[model samples]
Target: MPELPEVEYTARQLRALIVGAAIQEAHVFWTRTIGYPDWHDFCAEIVGRRIEGVRRRGKFLLLDLSGDFFLSIHRRMSGNLLLLSPGWQIDTSLRETDNAAWQTRGPTFLPPTATDVAYSRETSHCRVCFDLADGRRLLYTDPRKFGRMELWPCFSEAEALHGLGPEPLEDAFTVEHFAEELAKRKTVIKQVLLDQSVVAGVGNIYADEALFYAHIHPLRRANSLNASEIDALREGIISVLALGIEHGGTSFSDYRDLAGKAGNNFDHVRVFQQDGKPCVRCGTLIERRVIAQRSTHFCPTCQQLIAE
Candidate 1:
């Protein structure tokens, strides 16, 4: 799944490529990808509009159009967005085609493949395509079909987007705010951070990484923390999220950047998927367990669970 960083990267890429382009047409291959207004309304309303800008709120990508409308996309699991010229052709079988390709020519060619080609003007797994006036195309593709594409007059009407916590990267999401939010939750610390309403844009990968960084066990109750622990957690959450953005996010599975390229952050991961591997800090073996039904990885030596 493409987490916050991955989704943010996609929005940034789209801003650079498609912001000024006018929508010549729109193609919706999968109707279910749009959550509201139905498929017919989406096509009629979005076409002929020019893209004003692209912005990301939490994990959702918002494309500001010429009028009051916006196109929102959520790449839930395997969703990706790719921008390409008319001549671009994606070969999904390239992994088998060249073993050294990613190592040698990988940087140049991979980001596009990480892009969602599910929707295109030509052949694609693209669920939606926005044809630009310049003959360029922006495509959204998700193989798992869990991704979503919707058109809205304003972002507030997208019920799922409303009431999300402040973005961790934003200037408004202060340590004091995070501390207050945690104070209100009696749930496990991990669960509190994972709650979008508590602090938006955090998911399994970042939640595990943040807990590992704070040296707080994933099962520790949210209200159990002292001021010092809360401070540490606040810093940990911001730092981990910042690092993930810097590294283009962790790409253990389907997560990729705007160009459809894989991210290298997986190599820098501390404990998320390093179970059974030696901890980088203390050489203790990393462990994995189910926390809130999600596979969580951490260092038992470093992160000790607080007793109830």
Candidate 2:
């Protein structure tokens, strides 16, 4: 699954290319991609609306439209967004084109072959496409089909986003906030960090990395931490997340940047997938275990199980 950093990267890339572009046409190849408002309503409502801006909240991408409507996309796993022009020739041999075409063409238009703008699937799993008036199209490709795209009124409340905990990178998520959230949970520290309601945007990869950085065991109870331990954990979480974003996110599986480029953060990971490798700090062998039904990687010698 593309976590916060990957989603944030995708949003940033989309914001740069799609903002101010009007939707000339809209197509929903997979009806299931739009979770709400029905497929017909989604197409009817989003067509002809200009993209005002693009933003991200947690793992959701929001494309603000001209009116009180926004396009929301959740790339659950194996999902990506690609921007292409009329001349774009997708390698249908390598990738499956879920849907393709121009939404609106200006008087002076570029030929499909001469446009020199192409967003190829490069792989067989391309799934959703959103055509814009500026001759550019936003495509959503997901091999597993676990992703979703939805349209809603601008005034619509994000019920799904409301209960999520504070963004770890925001000023609102201070050490005090982290401590408070942790104090309220009696679950294992790893489990608490993984809880979207406890702190949004954190996943197993980052949880493991943060715990390793803080020298906290995955099984440690959340409420057992002292003020100092809480502080360490807070810093660790922020540092790891910032690094992940700076490095374009980790690409352990099918995750890639908005342009379908691979991320480089996996090379910088300290312990997430380094099972049996030597720990960079203490020279101890990194270990992997199952916690909360997720694979966890850490150094047993570095992240002692003792409650701090």
- Winner by TM-score: 2
TM-score of 2: 0.88
lDDT of 1 by residue, 1-308 (tens): 87787777777767877778899987666678888779998899888998898998888888888878888888888777777666454344544676444222221212234343442322335666667788776777776678888788864555747778888888878878888888788887877887888777899989999888889999898878888988888788888888887888788766656665778788888998899999999999999988887888989999998676
lDDT of each: 0.77, 0.77
Task: Tell me the spans in candidate 1 whose CA falls farther than 4 Å from its real position.
Answer: 88-124, 155-160
The 10-residue segment with the lowest total lDDT in model 1: 102-111
Clash count in backbone of candidate 1: 15
